[model samples]
Every structure is written in structure tokens, then in C-alpha cells.
Target: MTSINVKQSGDQPNSTHCRWQWRDEELVLLAEKAIWRPVSQELFVADLHLGKAEVFQACGIPLPSDDDRATLLRLETLCERWRPKRVVILGDLIHGRLGLTDRLRADLRNLHRRLHAEVMLIGGNHDRGVQLGTLPQHPACRVGGLWLSHEPEQPIDGRDGLNLCGHIHPTTTLRQGPDRLRLPCFAFDNVEQRMLMPAFGELTGGHDCRHRYRKWLVAEGTIVPWFDSAHSSRASEVGR
Candidate 1:
């Protein structure tokens, strides 16, 4: 099976995205594009965009209507695997106001309503004006000295921590000769002191990573280590 290695500072050899010491805590960056904090027993997923396909269809765009179902099934699998005490969604739970059709809302409500973990939603720009209907909304949520938000904006709640954000749907592109491959990624901006998680929603789009950040691209059921290219962060990743 393919695996992702998370090396801290000078530590090397091998370890799955299982545990990276961050903020004095162990972070399990799952290959599935979610973060599992074993200490807190919390799972973090971002940019679910539940009804995104419906939103596109409403505009007469052709998109499979089952995107939401597929997305939720993944979430259910993660929850079953980790069984976290809490699940915090960084933001963009819905694509837009129009995406929340009655069926969509009911499905969301049912999913959260039955999950064993405590669910929290940080309102994203897309979430505004949508009827969340008792989905445990918050403007920003703080967890383990990290500021969790939908966007990379500064914390408005006057609290402080490293930012864990989504909405940019960060991705990294690899090029060799004439072939180009693009994959979703977990990108960290050291200067800005924030990390952007890849979009959890399967049907979502991605924004390219800026050269300044270190990237770990998710492809083929594993996190592809940064290549030897100029934009690479670590020397560990070999192109697969």
C-alpha cells in the first residue's frame, strides 16, 4: 500500500502521515485528506461543500447529483475509522446558499444528528445566508492552540493560535518534460504560520500552491512527497 511520510525537522527514515509533532501535539495527517489528532481524539476535515453539484446543476451545468452522497460516505468511513470525540470542519460546508435544497439540508441534518462525535462548523463565506438549521455553527473555533477558520483571514474572535484553514482548496502541480500532473495538497506557509488542508469534497476545484509554501500532494491513495524540483520543500519525496 502507498503511504505518506511526515518527518519533523531533522527526523527521517519512515513514518506514515500518522504522527507529526505540531504545537506540542501529535497530528495524524491521514492520506485520506483529513487530520486526526490522537491526543484530542478529534478529526478535522475541510471544505465539504455538500451540495456543490446541485448548485452547479441549478445553473444548468452538468454535474453528477450523487457527489453529496459520495462525499458523505467518505466522511462516514473516516468517522468510523477514527471514532474521534469531535469533528471540526474548517469551512465551506456548502458551496452556496442555493446548494442547500430541502433534501440536502435534511441529509446533512441527519448525518450530523447521528454522528457520535461532537460536530462544529466554522461559518465560511459560502455558508452565509444559508439555513444551517442547528448544525452547531461558530464564527471561528479554537482547537489545540490552533485557530480554525474557513478562510485564511486573521482571527476576529481575539483569540490566538496557528491557523488551520481551508477554502483555497490548495493543490500542487508537477511537471516533467511535456507531462503535467496536478493533485490536491496540504500546504504550509511558514512565514504566515498557517496550514491549508486540501478540500475534503471530492468534486471541488483546487487553487495552485504558491512557490513560497511547502507542499505534500495527495495522489493515488498516498501523499506524494515533494519532488526534487525547485518548488519542493523536503528532499525525501521521490516522484512515483
Candidate 2:
């Protein structure tokens, strides 16, 4: 596990004061990702494309060979540490219309059996044809304070409070010295009360976000404010 340090900046005292810790709580932010314990140790991940590489290969797009296996391994490593009771996939569990191949299905089934945790899926754009209903579904399922869903909706008054969603694979640009880096990030909207997660899929693409909401750049295994002027300039240049 990576050790995270909390630093205080004069400009943003409140935000900086927020320590990134993994505990049983309503809200915990880690490396630009928010962890919510709505139902015990249930961990939520968004946009994990199990068979993305195979789908791309079917389309004649030659991608790196080990993308799917690598992503599954990454998830396994995360789950092994967290030891969650369940894993709720927010959306886009599969990539493309090809759906879950036999190999991918077997991988998911094996993961669920090995972890001994229930796996739930909320349908997303790419999951239209996928038979997620064939998998287990839980009643009163949730992540954070909001009910998990594929699409983002306006918050209903006095209900659930906020929605935890992932569809727009958000990315932010940061400038360090003369060079600039565009990194995948998680975006939180305080006014709208929605949390957009960074895509967890190894074969997925990201949408660079500027002029949308406040951004936090995820680099060096920590979440930092992407508010520096140079960062803005780098974002502008990349936008152009």
C-alpha cells in the first residue's frame, strides 16, 4: 500500500485539511477517488472494461495483448487489500458492443467466487446488450449517499443527498516546470452534488475536463489541486 501524506496550503486551508484516510465512513477521499461505505466494506469501481481488448481486436484495432488480464489483476489486488463484502460496478462494466466473451465472463465469475463477495453491475452506455440481469442484483444497493446508476440525474430534494457516478472519464492537465502532463482525475461537483469517478478500465479513454468543474490532478499516487496558473495555461494549450 502507498503511504499518503496530508499537506496544508495557505490558500486552501479547508480542502487541504481534509486528510485522505481509508476508514469506515460516509466519505473518504483517496488519490482523487472517493470511498464510501454504504453497505459494509462494499467497494465501488467505475468503467472496468473486461473484454475491451478483444472487442478492439474484433474491429481490427491491434491493441497491447495483456490489457484485459492486467485490469483484472489490478482489481484483484485492490479487492485483496480492501476485503470488501461486495463490489458495485458503477457503469460500463464491459467495453464495446461485442459484450462479455466466454473468457471475460469466466474471469468475472472466478473473481467473484475467489473474493467471496457479491458482484453487482449497473448498466451503462456500453452495457446496453449485456445481460447484467443474469448476474446477481441487490435490493437497497448504494454507494456513498446516492443510489448507483449509469446516468447522472439532478438530486431529488432530501433524498439520498448525492449521486456517485462515472460516465465521463474525467482527466485534468497539470504543468510541472516547462512540461505539461494530462492525467486521469476524479471531479466533484459541490453545487450539483455529484461525484464523477476516473475510469478504472485499462483500455478505456478519458475526456479532458476544463471549464466543467473544479479539478483535482491525480499524480504521484496523491490527489492535488490543479489550480496553479501554469496548469491552467497547460490545459488551455492542450484544449487548443
Candidate 3:
């Protein structure tokens, strides 16, 4: 089993972040559902799905207008605080072609201009080969020794790596017989050497994680190590 060291970050005294030693690298799991590489000074977030609320509104399904704004604000806050050398977004940067609005575009452009770091995006299925406004899109890229992409690596196709990916928008459920709740989580597949990021977007749906991937729940502005309900003993054993 791969060794992992987890600790609550004192620097983030509010408990908004945790420092994790995964493999040979140090990764910070932020309450924003993003990853921070202290050594590289790089910030990684996934599945922003910006403009999703706007797209829903277009379909006559009413959703609050602030989703886009709230998401952008989070991104801006992360960038400003971390001041990373670059910001890497895993995938699904925007909800759909329909999500694009003049205001959204302008806000994105303004955010781009204001950020001092380089921005990189990997287009996802929702992207449909369409770039995020004027942002550059690449099929995949390597950063900080990890295969960074929107989708998970397929070993059968001969593609594999210590990958950092985001498309699944992983979540775990808690049920108390009549009550049930779902929470977003980051999942790690040790054998595959993949770290699956949770959706960074507010208006997003999620898939239950595969049992093989141990999970870290992003809850209540804290990153919590969570063992599987069915196999709590095994999950805890592996996580430790």
C-alpha cells in the first residue's frame, strides 16, 4: 500500500485546509475542493462548470443567478491567497455552450487579467472541443510529475500515470435509515496511482466513488478522512 501522511494545517487555522503527504509529494487539500502544491506553487481545481445556473435558466429551470459569480469569486480568492505560479483547471470549465453570457465572459476575462499566474485548462466532454472563452485548451499535460487531465487514465489503452483527474465529481453518501445525505469527496486509487478530484462547482452532480479508491470528504469547510461505510475497517486500514 502507498503510504500517506495526513495532518490538519496550522497555517490554515480556520481548518479550511489540510496538508497531505501522498507518495513522495506534499499536497494541500483545500476546503474549496482544490489541491495546492506547495513545492511547485501550483493550484489545481476541477469541474468549475461555470455559468451552469445561467444555462439552467435558459432551459426555463430557474436557478439562482449567483452561481457563476460565487464560483469565480472562489477561484479569485484562491489565486490571490496562494499566489501560485500557475492555476490548472482539470475539466468542464464551463457548463455548456449555452452557459456563456456577456457578463460571464467579461468576468472571466477580468479574472484572467487580474491573476498574476499563468492559467491552463484541459477541455472535458462538456467542452465539446470548445475552448473556455479565449483560454487555451490542451488535450492533456504533465505538471508536478502527475498526468493532469479531465478524464482518468486507462491502463488497458496503455495510458497510465500518477494522474490527477476530475471528471467523476466523486461523492459519498451517509444514510440513517430514513435520512440520507451526500457529500463531495476527493478519492484516491492507490493501485492506479490516480487522485480523483471532487467537483469544484457549486451546481454539480456527483457519482458514488468506486470502493477501491479511498476517500477524503470535503465537509463543513474541512477536509475529513472518511472510511467506506460497507468496508470501514478495510478502508481505514488502507488509508492508514
Candidate 4:
């Protein structure tokens, strides 16, 4: 288990929202912690570190054991709400071999059956340590002229389609008064034509998205635009 220092995120109640547009495709960024592609009717999520709590508990870190269940339920909820035809898990579906348990496997199979959506996984670093069955070991996947990956690596020169990835577990810091809140975010690097997704697991920590790109912070049940630079603070907020 990676001994990462976890931060408790603030709770905000809001409807599932935060939509964006790219390449003539409408992206519905659900507060449920998934991206809904309207054109393909697919949901894209990343970095679900299932069974991470068990790993931490084994390492003497006091963490709740329900982390895996919570993560799975959240995904199920999104599926029920959006009714996507398919769900594309970017990477790191499970934490590692030790984290992969029979119970977890059962839950995954059950969820797959319940959602009845074609689930595609593009393996990530953690997934490399285990045999996740049928899912490809390829570093990237192509779907509808878009590149889906676990890491945000630039494509070969002039490669067509934009790259969407998750690994860093990006987040944005919002300041109000003397306090600052670190919230999960979607980091879009317009310059690189790549987007970084937030960690979808409840027990997962986050990487502060300090890169110089636009970000959408999940707040008050909606997605708000967070400008890393004072220059872009004048932009409008984006959400449902």
C-alpha cells in the first residue's frame, strides 16, 4: 500500500452537473465523479483505487473498510442516473494484487451485470501487478477519434484526436477568507490537448493541479471554474 497522506474533503450537496464541450462533443461532467460523453453515450472514469482501505489497514493505518463498497456504489449510482451504453475506466481500477480480493471481484461482476453496460479498461501502473482478466495491457486506447490513457503522455507527433487521461488524481484549491479548500477537479491542458481526471475512489488522495491550465472544481454540488492565474479569474463559472 502506498502510504499517502489523505486529506478529508469538504462535503457539498448538489445535483450531478458540470458539463463541457470539446470537438463538437458534449461532455457531461457529473458531480457523481464521472464524465458522460453524449455523442457515444459512454461514461469515462479514472483511478478507482478499490480495496485501498484494506491495504492501508494492513499497514496499521486506521481506515474504514467500506471504501471499496462506497466506490463501487458510486459508480453504480452514476450508471443508473446516466444510463450510458458503455463505461470506459481509464486505469488503476484496483489498487494492486494484494488489494484485489474475491469479494471485490464479486462486486465488480455484480455491478457489471447490473449496469449491463460494456465496460472497457485501459490498464494502469497499479493494475500491471495483477491479472484483471480480459482487459488489455495496452498503455492507451482509441475510441471515437479520442485517445484514452492512464497517464497524460503526449501522442506521437501530429497524432489525431485529443488525449484524455487520469493518474495524477488532480484537484484544485479554492480560497475563501482565511481558509482554503482542496477539491477534486478536472484539469484540462488546452495547450497539450489532454485532460486529467480526478480520482473517482472515495479513499483516494489527490495531486494539487498546479499546472498552468484551466480547471473545474467540484463545489456545492456543482462544478465551478477555478483559475490558477489571477489573469483568468474573470472567466465565467461552468456547471449545470
Candidate 5:
């Protein structure tokens, strides 16, 4: 692992208020609006639409280039630090029909080789081409206690285990002074033992989660708890 210091920025909110609990050896922090597993050495991120930029460009969206490279480098930096055995992307690893371009394919192949750990894709709505086939298969893969998949399914009571999933890029709108920020969040359905991770890809968009579900909102590198019932009312009241 890279020996560089991983310090939290002083400008960022104090995460001491962020609730945390342990599962096995994992340091589960409700940070970045996701249940972070520090020991897996992997930062389980979901909805990384790697080729979304390319797809948008092809569709004449006129977005800036280098989004893919930027996202990959971010992941690379994390990998260098955590040195995880593997990065289990919950789902939606790719975007639309762009699949993995030659550049991205080569980059991913090189990354896989360099990381020395498997990069498992659970398969999602946007996955296409040989990308789905190329990802490593299961028995070797796991999240919490359940096998990972693209979409979230109702787990059998007791017998069903925790499933980490993504697809509905979840986000919540919060008021900060006069400005309203739509912060990406992690939604945890405790009754279901299932968690939805925020979209890790730069090109990905998020859906408003207010009044829909209880969530942990992550912004400025800090996690804030918000219940579904209070979302809209709180937002409106804070705005005034």
C-alpha cells in the first residue's frame, strides 16, 4: 500500500458525528453516505458508469473529455492507499452501449494486472458488450454475506443476508445557508439488510431521495444522517 498520509481536510466537516459500527473485522463507517468497509481493504463503491462520458459524447452531449481517465485515476489512488485484495463494484460498472472502449479496455486490463487483485463487476442495467463476460465470476466474490448482483432483491428473512447494490444513483438535497446542495448519499434499509452506494463515476447523475427513504448524506467528506419523513419539511424549513 502507498505510505502517503491519508489525512482528512480541515475544511471538511468533522466526521465524529457520523455513526459507525463494526461487522467482523471491517470498520464500517457511515461515510460518503455508504457503509465503508475499511478492512476489506476495498472501498466498495457502486454505479461507476465508466463509459458514460463516451456515450454522452457520442450522443452529442458536448461534455468535456478525460472524465474516464479522471475517474480511473481516482480509483487508482484509492487502490494504492487501501491496497485491497479486490474492488467489488456493486453494479452498473459500465454505461449504455459504449461498453469498454479500446483505451478503457486496455487501461482496465492494465489496472487489473497492476492491482494484483480481482475487480469484480456484479453486472447492472448499463453493462453491455463483452464487459459483462469479462468480469470475474462468483464463489470468490461476496458482499456482507450475500452474493452481489445488479439489482436489489428482497432477501429471505433471516436466511437472506446483506446485499450491497446500486442503480438508482441516490442523492439528497440539503440547504447550506442560501445555497442548496444535492449531495450524493447512501441509503440503508436496515429491515432489509441492504445498502445502496452512491454513484462513484463522475459522469453519473443522481436522483433526489428526499421524502422517499431514510439516508445518510455525504458532502464535503462528511456524513450526515437524515430520515425520510423530515427530508422535504426540513429542506423547505431550512431554505426559509
Candidate 6:
């Protein structure tokens, strides 16, 4: 097992952002909105829900058509920066089959052509409606000592590894006096040994998860590790 100690940046209390150490690998929680594993040369993004805007538009709901474009651009920027060998998407690659417009398909195809990294998608509940040819699909995959999946589930009977998943679209709420702030966050359940990724989709909503385990809030181009009120004073102290 691996352990984490408090990480300090310069002289400031840098509890908001830090690399995640697991087993024998060190993973970077990128501000570009994805997990970058330098050891494996892979990037993990979850709950993309591509084509989501189209789904809403189909239902006569006025939604921005540029939603997918924005999501793809963010991904492309990350790809350009990290230059990973593979980009593993946890799930919700597409909102639905009907929502997969030709333009969206072309955009994805172009993205795959432009980037050197291989993109792979794992099926999720929302993925059931996606056409098979829209995106390459897999049930699950193994990365280093981690099990990657769309839904947060324990690995098969004998497998022993930390599970990384994205389905609930975890978010965290911060309360200060009468003011409160809610933001998408990466949630880690220490007891279950699982990590929940925030949604990468531009149009998808988030589910607020304000439980006790560790949380990394993504805001304003920075990833912040949130310490509860009880432990706020010790935020500078490191060690898991």
C-alpha cells in the first residue's frame, strides 16, 4: 500500500492541490480536468457524456450546441500538454444514440486523428444507448495497480487493486458562515479504497458529495484538496 503526506507548495498552505500516490504509481490531478499518470503515460477522464447537448436539443430544450466542441477542446489541450500514450475514458462517452449527430462523430474522428494518444471508452448506463461504432467500448481495464471502470464497483473476486471510477459525478460543498460554495470535486473514499472522478462533460450536471473522505476540488484552474472544519487547522500537516 502507498501513503500520502501533506504537500506544501512554497510557503503557502497548499492543501488544495497535490499528486495522488497509490501503490507504486504517482498520479497527477491536472487542472485541465483529468488525472495524468506519468508512470503509465496515460490520462484518465470520466463521465464525458459527449453529445449531451444534442440530447437536450432533441427534446426541444435550448442548449448550447458548442458544448461538445468545448469539451473536446479541453481534452485536446490536455492531450497536447501531457502527450500520453493512451487516454482512458471511464464512461458516459455519449449521451444517447439519437444524440450522436454527424458533426459530433466527425469531431471525434478528427480528434482521434489529430492526437497520437489512443482513446478508449468503458461502457456506462448512459452508454447503453450509444451506437457501437460511435466509440470503441470496453467493460473495464487495468492500469498499474488500479482498476478502471465507469461505475464504482469492487473488482472481480480475486483482484486486489485500488478502483478508479466516475459515475456519480461527485461534487463538494463548502460552507462559510452564511455563504456556501459548491464545486465539482474528485472524491476519494479512504475506507473503500476507491476514487471518484468529477464529470468531464461540459453539459453534464454534478451530484454533491460532502462526505468524510478526502476531496480535491477543481476550481479556477487549480485543484484544491479540501480539509474539513475539524481538521482545517492541520491542513498543512501531511501524512495519510
Best by TM-score: 6
Q: Rank the candidates by TM-score, best first.
A: 6, 1, 4, 3, 2, 5
| Candidate 6 local lDDT, residue 71 | 85
Tens-place lDDT digits, model 5, residues 74-135: 77766676667877777666676664688777776676666566787666667634444356
RMSD of 4: 7.3
lDDT of 3 at 117: 80
Put down candidate 6 lDDT per residue, 94-200, tens digits, no spaces. 88876788887887776666667788888888887556464677887777688888998887746787889999898765544445466788888887889898999
Error of 2 at 200 (Å): 0.4
lDDT per residue as tens, model 4, 51-72 = 8887777778888788787778
Tens-digit per-residue lDDT, 182-240, candidate 1: 77988878777788999999888899775677666677666655533443532214333
lDDT against the true structure, each candidate: 0.76, 0.65, 0.78, 0.75, 0.63, 0.76
- In terms of lDDT, the poorest run of 10 residues in model 6 is 231-240
lDDT, candidate 2, 21-74, per-residue tens: 222336444452435364477777888876887777788998765787877777
TM-score of each: 0.85, 0.77, 0.83, 0.84, 0.76, 0.86
Candidate 3, backbone clash total: 0
Q: In terms of lDDT, which candidate is stronger, 3 or 5? A: 3
lDDT of 2 at 169: 86
CA shift of 89, model 5, Å: 1.0
